[model samples]
Target chain A: MTELTEIKKQDLLYQGKAKEMYTTNDPDILWVHYMDQVTALNGKKKVQMKDKGKTNCAISARLFTELREQGIVSHFIEQLSPTDQLVQKVQIIPLETVVRNYASGSFVKRYQTEYLQKFDQPVIEFFYKSDELDDPFLNDDDALALGAATREQMAQIRQLALKANQHLRQIFAKMNVLLVDFKLEFGLTAAGDVILADELSPDNCRLVDLDTKQSLDKDVFRKGLGEMVPVYEEILQRLLKEGER
Target chain B: MTELTEIKKQDLLYQGKAKEMYTTNDPDILWVHYMDQVTALNGKKKVQMKDKGKTNCAISARLFTELREQGIVSHFIEQLSPTDQLVQKVQIIPLETVVRNYASGSFVKRYQTEYLQKFDQPVIEFFYKSDELDDPFLNDDDALALGAATREQMAQIRQLALKANQHLRQIFAKMNVLLVDFKLEFGLTAAGDVILADELSPDNCRLVDLDTKQSLDKDVFRKGLGEMVPVYEEILQRLLKEGER
Candidate 1:
């Protein structure tokens, strides 16, 4: 990938709750630094922890590589360091695509459904990603009305997201983790192809241990279950076993 | 329409917050009695007002007839009395289909947009009709996951709802009322054709006068504006002027 050793991280492009994005010497590349931080409630509550960034960095890189091997296009290029990576820069769509295999998080809160209730079919939802608007849950029509994406783009995102889900569930299942649900951010390439973007980590997924039923994701931070990074590392350790197949 | 004189209302089928349904002699027909009661917050608030039912009955019948003339198939058959009508009994789909020309009500609450921001195009949303679940807002996928509607039925519902909105907006415009938004319900006929069901009235529509921008619908009761019945009567008077055209 584009002489990875020669790439230089430049100016900071963005600083999100858990990651920092930087422009790179290569115009099409972005440098992402996973931070030793975690957040819940849309960054209302945040904390710093050791090894969080490295664990996430390894997991995201491995997963993106695995997904790419399965022919799912993403922005991820390659991992540069324990907590840094290079990815293709894309115009981020302002909609968050969520795929749910079982009920958890907001799904349980909104519908009062039983926790871990397996859906007969995966349920997909969209949310306008505006912190000012608290990322209000929306439908495809709302996405179009907001100019977040077009009908064809949404259809494309749906196809890509479902494919990602099928592959991801298999990966997690091999780790003995139930992928309850996950949030995805899509972006348009310069040529206008919708592709998966943003970091894939426990920060955006609700994962549960199949046997212990313990949460191995950010819910540890959100629900105050206990130490957070250890669980994420558990995920990283498991993924290392299920590493880039 | 069956002979209104010979039809007999038998067993009470269902009692809703604002209306009651009864089995009729004709197997294909159901008797609807619009109650004087008005409830908000999903029936958590309740009140009875004089002429509320009759005004709604007249308005719903007139609008339904107008839509039928425009070739939009609906369950409405004929008016029976000031507060009653005959409607074809189809299995009601448990989803609230909402169409919005301008944002108001929950749209404002959810996204915090301006109270009456006109949309580039009508925005459609669906809410799962469940009191036990507080009628959670859902997308097409969620509806399918809930077994609320089939894919084909939802597509047909969207088409019919949009057409109804087109004609309803025109009817309201003639009366100088801004058709901000409204909710609809659809049912499946025995033949499995999706058709519009449920009464259309100020109770389900947000209407505002063009000149004064005054609320002419249930917001009177909801926002404690003033006497709710007189405002509904004002709408009836205006619709009567735009009658049968």
Candidate 2:
């Protein structure tokens, strides 16, 4: 691995619930530091798990690289450290794009249905990201009325999300994990091209063991079921083993 | 209104929260009996207003006539009585189509915004009409995933909803009333045609005075502002005058 002795991390650009951003020496890149901290219910619940950041970084790096190989573009540049990465700096859109391959989480609650209702196709939802208002779910009209995204951008976002769902679900299926649902965020580069920009790991995805239906993602912590570090580590190990093949 | 001396109301087919349905002697027609009961928040808040049935029937008949004149087909046949109407019976779709010309009521609560946010274009939303589950908002994907409506049917529903919004907004504007938003329902005929059903009145619409911004619809009862009879009467009077012209 190359040492990051030349690049410097300057002023803190922003701090999120589970990550920190810093200005970097390269004008086109930003330093992303994944934190061990995790939050749920819009920060009502919080916890710190050892090695969480390292595990997530590893998974995100591998997935983003794999997605690129699959013809889906992202903002990932390269991993600088175990918990830090240098990514192409883009203006993050104020939306959380969600894709549900199966009925779970808020989908079940909203529809008042039983768990894991398999959908014939993936359902894409866009939520306006405002923690103050608990991130209200939005449709295309709501998005346009609020000036969150244009019609063309929304169409692109939906297409990209469905593509990612197909690729990621297959990848997890190979490891005997069911990629139930996940949230995504997109950003616009300086040239106004929308590309995937957020981390893709257990923190943002719901993964269930195919045989046991046990939660292997953040749902464990969110539901107060068990330790998240071991499950996250398990995910990382699975991905790494696949990479070796 | 035509007298119903020859027609006979047969078996009670169904009873909704605000209306009752009865089979008619014509076999192809159904008798819609509007009730005075007004419900909101999924029937959690309700009250019986005197003359509500008669007023709503008059308003719905006039509006339906106006919409038909504007080239929108519906099931409305003719007014049989002040509180009853003859309509074509069809299998009702389990979805409520909503068109919003301005942000109000649940829209404001969903987005956490103040009321009366005018839209340059009307927004259309679909809700699965289930009283047990409070009729959750749905998109085209959700509707298809739940087997609620086919893609072709949803496309038609959306187009018809937008068309209805355009026609209704213009009609209300002519009466010095701002048609904020309204709900609609569509049903398939025995011959498999989707036509508009359900009453359009103060209960199902949010109408504001163009000059005073006064609550002229069910918000009068829902928000405990004042009596609703006078405002409904005002609406019916205005429409009747427009009809005479």
Candidate 3:
């Protein structure tokens, strides 16, 4: 607590659509300020919702802490405030690692098939995170040939992503939430180890009510199904209740 | 020759942008009539070129024959005419197998990168061949989940495509032509064996002069750079000359 009060934010390092990154007193640490902004379709559709950032921070902190306890390494250090956190400084690999338990969203759209298609196994995909090209879907070979990621890094990323999906699927199932699919980002540490670096929240995940098929994640905001912040809060509260139990 | 004369082009079975298929006397054999039509960007740009179909037939027949000599199985049976061929009847898998030695065309456009970026190793990609969705790029898992291809089928397709790539790369290099990339299709025989299928020609391959980097394949018609029929004829002539040696 003393070090937290003494350390000061130095300079803005980077600003993304939904979060701002800043340098901190410790060179190995960074400060992430999650904004109230929610973006869909790569920020083409966006809105600022009250307490959205706080909800995301709570969910991400709890999930990352749980993941660490489960032996998955991540960059999350500590929650500094309701909507801010301190994290390890790492170079982000410019790829969006997506894992899917069901065919939805871009999957259904790309295949031009009926929605809510179930799969016997989960699917993992990667997209180059460039807004200019609209984040085109990339295969393993494309990732290597384009120099976006090495074969070793991609293998590790896929392994970690599937593990995260399995853990999240179990956690959400306890709350009667179906974890449909989610996106993850990884970064290379100074030691060249790839670690999960992005916040895991409704904003980066697709969750639905197991019974009603109603949206419980960012799809609620993307589809205008209902107010999103309350749903995110609901998710956080459900997890907290499960923790207590 | 006797069977070719006796078996007339029967009922039209299928009609694609560049070719037409007809049932034959034997259920195991089908007749393919390649048309003079040329299409690019999924048929958004199209034109009918004189003798284009004939040129493609010559190249595909010769290549398939050579591949057969190299112990690779394919659907090609025999050439019936300049623009028509008899092929084994098999169910065509709806995935386009694309192999690349250099980044060009849609690859450059999708990644928004400079063209002609070389790769140390060839890159293999798959696209679900649906005109409705504009033939979206598909990962191996996406193919399985969407029922486009099985894991086993995908594995076999990749092996065959890379093998074909190696053979073609060597053949073209002999003529001082660099084989940039090419698209392939596979089909399942009645015996449940996946075999190489579909025509291979300048229309489906990217070729450039090794020394001058001059476009020698479909890019001529795709980019409206110049006449394509002459270039296709040139490719066929070069391959024929190599056969003589």
Say which candidate scores most in TM-score.
Answer: 2
| Cα lDDT, model 1, residue B214 | 94
Better of 1 and 3 by TM-score: 1
Q: How well does chain B match by TM-score in each candidate? A: 0.97, 0.95, 0.96
Residue B210 deviation, candidate 2, in Å? 1.1
Q: Can you give the TM-score per candidate against the true fold? A: 0.96, 0.97, 0.94
Winner on TM-score between 1 and 2 is 2
- DockQ, every prediction: 0.80, 0.71, 0.84
Name the top lDDT candidate. Answer: 1
lDDT of 1 by residue, A108-212 (tens): 888777899899888889999998888999998878876889999898988988999999999999999999999999999898888999978998899999999
lDDT of 3 by residue, A1-245 (tens): 23766667789999888899999888888999999998888889878888999899999999999888887899999988898999998988888999999888988888876677777899999999888788899998988877889999999999999888889899999999999899999999999999999899998889888888888898887888888899999999999998898
Question: Which pairs clash in the backbone of model 3?
Answer: none
In model 2, the runs with Cα more than 4 Å from the true position are A1-6, B1-6
Give the runs in model 3 whose Cα sits over 4 Å from its true position. A1-8, B1-8
Model 3 misses residue B48 by how many Å?
A: 2.6
TM match of model 3 to true structure: 0.94
Per-candidate alpha-carbon RMSD to the true structure = 1.9, 2.4, 2.3
Clashing pairs in 1: none
